[model samples]
Target: MSSSRRVRPLTALALAASAVGTLLVTAPTASAGDYAGACIRSVGSRTSPNGWLIPARNFQAGSSGTCVREIQFDIAATIGLDPADAPGFIDGAFGPKTDRYVREFQSRSHLEPDGIVGPRTWEALISRTTD
Candidate 1:
C-alpha cells in the first residue's frame, strides 16, 4: 500500500484520540455561530457542515455558545425534540432543558447519562446524528 493509504488510518485514530478541548482562534462553524460563553474548539474543521462543535472542556448546565448550539441540534435531532414545540431545544444555551435532553440522549445511547458532553458524548452524538 502507498504511504498515504497507511497514513489515513493513523490520522483517523489521532482524530478519535483528540480530546474534547483545543482552542481554535478561527471563526466558528456555520451551524453554530459565535455566541456568548462560546468555546472555540478545533475538534473539527471550522467550515462546519452540520457536525458537533465540541468545546475545550466538558460542557454542562451552565455552558452556552457555538458548542452548545451544536450539541443541542444533534441531541434534539436524535431524541426527536421538535424545535417548534421546544424552542430551547436548539437555543444555543446549555440550560436545564438542554441538560435534561443530554442525559436522555446519553441514556438511550448507553452512556453514563451525566448530562456532560465530553469526548464520549460528542463521539456518540456525532455517530448517531445522520442528518
Candidate 2:
C-alpha cells in the first residue's frame, strides 16, 4: 500500500472517527487490558477494504508509537521475515530501523512493502484472532 494509505498513530483520532458506523471504539481506559481487549474486538471482527483485519495493536496514548513498533516486530516475527532474528526497541517512533523492519515485513507478507501501515497491511497483521 502507498504511504498515504498508512495510518499513523499520531492521526489515530482522526482515522478512528472515519470508522463511525462500521467500527466500534471503546472508551479509552488506563488499563492495557482494556486496550488489548478492545483492540482484539475491533480488529478481529472487521475486514478492511483489502480483506484484511486492520491492526489493533497500536492506538494507545503514550504507546501509540510503540504499538506500531511492536506490530512491526510481531508481524515480522510471525511471518519469518528477515530481521525477525532481531529484537525491536518497542519505542513508538518510525525511525530508519523501524522503517526497514516494516519494509521487510511487507515483503514477507507479499504486500507492497512501502513501510506504510495502511488498512491492507493492518488487515494482514490482525488476520488471526488476538488472545
Candidate 3:
C-alpha cells in the first residue's frame, strides 16, 4: 500500500539477480583440470565438530602457490606408484614430465587416454589409498 511495500518486490528481484550474476562470474566453466595449463585443483575433506563432512577445494597453481611436485606426489601415490620412479621431481610445476606420469597413471587406471586429471582421475587416486 506504500512506496516501501511496492519497492520490496523489485528490491528482492534485484538482489536475486545480483547473487546469480556473482556466482556465474566467479564459478569456473570447468574444474581446474579442465584446462591444459599447468594448474590443477586439489580437494580436501575434513570432519567438522558437528560430525558433518566438508569437502574443500585447494585451488593450486591458479593464484595459489601449489607446487606441481606436491600434486605429482599425490597423483603418483593415488595411482599406486612411487614418486622416485616418476619422471618429475616433487616440484610444484606441472610440465611435460608430469603429463607423462599422468598418462601412465591413466592407462594403469583403465581410464580414457586423456592426460588431464579430472574428478575421475582424482577419485581413482583416492581409491588407491583406500584400497
Point out where model 3 deviates above 4 Å.
Answer: 1-67, 78-88
Best by TM-score: 1
Error in Å for residue 86 of model 3 = 5.6
| Window of ten residues with lowest summed lDDT in model 2 | 57-66
Error of 3 at 81 (Å): 6.9
- Give the TM-score (vs. native) of candidate 1: 0.57
Q: What is the lDDT of residue 63 in candidate 2?
A: 31
What TM-score fits each model?
Answer: 0.57, 0.46, 0.43
1 against 3, candidate with superior TM-score: 1
49-115, model 2: which lDDT tens digit per residue? 7665454433322334434554644554455444453554444456666666667766877988777
The global C-alpha lDDT for each of the candidates, from Candidate 1 onward, is 0.68, 0.54, 0.53
Query: If candidate 1 were superposed on the true structure by all CA atoms, what would the RMSD be?
Result: 15.6
lDDT assessment of candidate 2:
0.54
